[model samples]
Target: MTPMQLDLNLLAALDALLEEGSVAGAADRLHVTAPAMSRSLGRIRRSTGDQILVRTGRTMTPTPYAIAVRAQVHALLQQVQGVLAPSHELDLTTLERTFTLRWHDSLVALGGAALLAAVREQAPGVRLRFIAESSTDSPGLRRGEVDLEANANPPAAADVRAEKVAETAQVVVVRPGHRLAGEPAQPMTAEQYAAADHVAVSRRGNLSGTIDDALARLGLARRVVATAPSEATALEFVRDSDLVVTAPQATTRRASADLGLVVLPLPLDLPPASVYLSWHQRYDTDRAHAWLRELARTALDAPNRRA
Candidate 1:
């Protein structure tokens, strides 16, 4: 048999009655007459198939069923309100909100400086909350804890909005005055490339990725001498040793003068690594949210990109 649905009005009336424990008080709270409140409670009892209330000497008492449904009832009401409430447009100049962003540290080292500068110029009152996790995507965006995910290379996901924020080529970085300084990077031979011990970058202690796979296909591979989580450590290692490292071109260029590293184009058919802007569809049209995304795009500043 199909169940007949009761009006939500009765549920609201029952909630007030349960809260006050007095018929007159519940009526006053709901701005209804005592008789009207009583009628709503009667309807609630029929719909629930329970004797939800019993009269005490001066007040009403809830039955076990009423107590069981109270929390669920309130939760539903809150959801209804959240759905109907309007999302106010943010005023950038005076708006103060914390936006959480997740990304791999490689991006932070490469693009964070420029990204922050752009945000500061546009929204001075905004604060950044960042998480540096290599696998920070999908679940992070859906959970609302992460507003953006910046990745070294775009990961595979369906319906995820992403675009190239920046284009970076894999460059062999070496310290100045090193044994291989000023050597022609272009037209590099696979044998010359694999000749040096490489410092690999990763969040995990393990050090291997697409670059290694490509090298293997060509019957050549570089020796990974060490692994680090961030570019800072990589630069530190390069500063004191002859170890050659491959990193995104932007990061290598930015730290070249300071860390004394120089860029060399990879000889084999290495694909261009691109940094992507990834976000969920939930905030697809949100104006304030889009503004932040634009700032990130601008900061990345791809050769043919707009934020």
Candidate 2:
């Protein structure tokens, strides 16, 4: 085929038609009418001298040639998009965009105000929508529904990019008059800590965690009286009742003070929480997205700030 005679538009239409196997579906995918798609199919057929799609018993099927070239066409389209995509040079001051950030409730309760302030001071036109994460394996980032996700551990998907924003240790917390708090100077033994009614915080609503595993190694088990979906809720439960909960030392420090609760070192040893900022690989080169990721890192990394 000659380059001058080949219309890129026709190539796109052909690819869509071959993939959809229906002119109406292809039209919907390309945001055009069925009649327009039919006309484009005709042009593609005339230029390529191949009936890209052949009608068979009220359904369309790709011809042998069409099937052979489908992969090549898709790869070519991706190359074209990459070449035509905008560059990484951004003017944040005047950039007007709404970025959706999905994070755990504790992160929002801890760092939402600081992040919003930082974004506002730098880009007045930018808007940040903070949404609660429903699960650890959420596909929001890969689906383009969420621009960024902040969590202690990054998603396991290979297509997602993650960067460590901060780290924090876990601390045990309880109400002021709880048995564990009466003797502030004396550290509770593992058995004494395990004997108390505990409130577990998990996004999946499980009653066990790394703490329980550690306790199991020592042949001890704590009674989990309740399970809260978020750390903020768990803290509230701990504040109003005798149940104890473990949470990030830095973020929960502020909440603990606000709730008038006592913070103590965790009886069970666990690794420090590594906070991360994650996004899909598709956004790796996007200018606005790159800046937003940097802004989040800066906000969370600020002195005395918790991730």
Candidate 3:
């Protein structure tokens, strides 16, 4: 058959076959007979000039070509469904959907409760899964594994949309009686701030960051006694010892307060940390997703407003 005569049903059948790796399993998924599914798979093989799935002993395995086109085929089917699906008014009261969010621990601590409360009140049937950030980069948004992300880092992918929802200034955190935390009227100088022992917050356990670079500009460098994998852990070190930690003001406010740590203005001039809300372009027009984004924007902005 020519390309013009290609059936959309064949695409569906191909997707199912590639995913299930067996005609019988594909038939069960598409609610068709195994014989019918085999026929459709034959047609797919002829159209693509490929034996998409080959029998490997008793089990079927996807060919290299089939594996290569699997994600593209699935994405195309989803796009077609979105385009052909009728636009209906969203009914949140009875909506049953779960959105997965991968966010920084700090952002979750700051805005998660508020976002959850808003979601529960607005759409009681909707659920949320707040996941931790990964150590390495991932295509979770593009793969639809993650529905939303809130963090300081912006996505670099062209298909991922990122919006800056909030910005928070950096502040130095130390124990209440620490020397740098001395006078309320007197501000700490760059030299004074850099003279103290410090604990860096680095996911990769690096001893330095932008703060170190800024200090080097002034020919000053603070000795980092330790590096913690997270801001929470770094703050714990600050609470117990003289190790100072520079952290974002808004997100760390509650935690610092709880730890009884003193927050001092950063002596060095630096741009505020930006909190970005990111999602895949495929969700741009999804009404439910759009609603969740708005709520998230509000929730993330709350801390900055209070700051």
Candidate 4:
């Protein structure tokens, strides 16, 4: 790899310029003179080998290159702030900032209530928003659109930081009084599970998944009659219908109240899956972020006993 040399000041200037899309606007945002901003922009253009922003008619337009690199610029800025502004301690009691987080609806049962309550109790000013589970989280986090991801089997990359937040097993769910609902005296058997029509949660519209794999290894299989984007939607589909839905215990717990469903341990045995909290490594030591991660761990693992 070619050795790289970059000035932190230049990166800051690039961040402002990319955000505002104009030298003058960047200068204003940075509280510097327009001429000074133009000079910094010139440096950026030379370093990047592209006119990061070009004047288009009455407005300054960011080139595709600028758009592509803006998120990196923002991340670099965040790192710089963390480094120079680092302290031995953090004051979250008075910290007021909105925190963006990504999670799926299924976790609502197990982690949601605790996560929200913990945030309120500790960092009262910190709020969260959920990202669609089916969407890729890296680009969104790197772009600063999402701060962290609550997910499973998170990507293992140099820039990614993931912490095991919870552990859960998938279980079969059906409405009360169904034929199979009361079929087993204990856990349902593999053959019995295979006979039920399942509603699958898949992003690619495929109707079968890991449950099939587990069953297949045991020489069994399930008949899938439906596919859905989320467990909530799947449970809703099977609410009053005769179809069965298998999902994370969290999902069954959350949807049970509204859907009036019963949770059954999957007849087939499988490893308990770990749910993780992930973020860019750049934020691993961030004070606010640290608080968020800590709270997430406590919230998610408290009831599950998976910490």
> Which candidate has the highest lDDT of all?
3
Name the regions of candidate 3 deviating beyond 4 angstroms.
1-63
* Cα lDDT, model 3, residue 253: 87
lDDT of 1 by residue, 32-53 (tens): 9999988887777777778777
lDDT of 1: 0.73
TM-score, one value per model: 0.67, 0.75, 0.84, 0.78
lDDT by residue (182-301, candidate 3, tens digit) is: 888988999999999999887777888899899999999889989987889899999999889998998888899998989999999899989999999999999999999999999999
The CA lDDT of each predicted structure is: 0.73, 0.83, 0.91, 0.77
- Lowest lDDT block of 10, candidate 1: 298-307
Q: lDDT value for candidate 4? A: 0.77
Candidate 4, poorest ten consecutive residues by summed lDDT: 134-143
- Evaluate model 1: give its TM-score: 0.67
Show where candidate 4 strays beyond 4 Å. Answer: 1-10, 16-43, 46-49, 54-79, 183-187
- Clashing residue pairs in candidate 2 are none
Tens-place lDDT per residue, model 4, 151-209, is 66776666777778777877778888877777565566788789888889875677766
Q: Please identify model 2 stretches exceeding 4 Å from their true place.
A: 1-80, 303-307
| lDDT digits (tens) for residues 285-305 of candidate 2 | 787888788877876666345
Candidate maximizing TM-score: 3
Comparing 3 with 4 on lDDT, the higher-scoring candidate is 3
When sorted by TM-score, best at the front, the candidate numbers are 3, 4, 2, 1
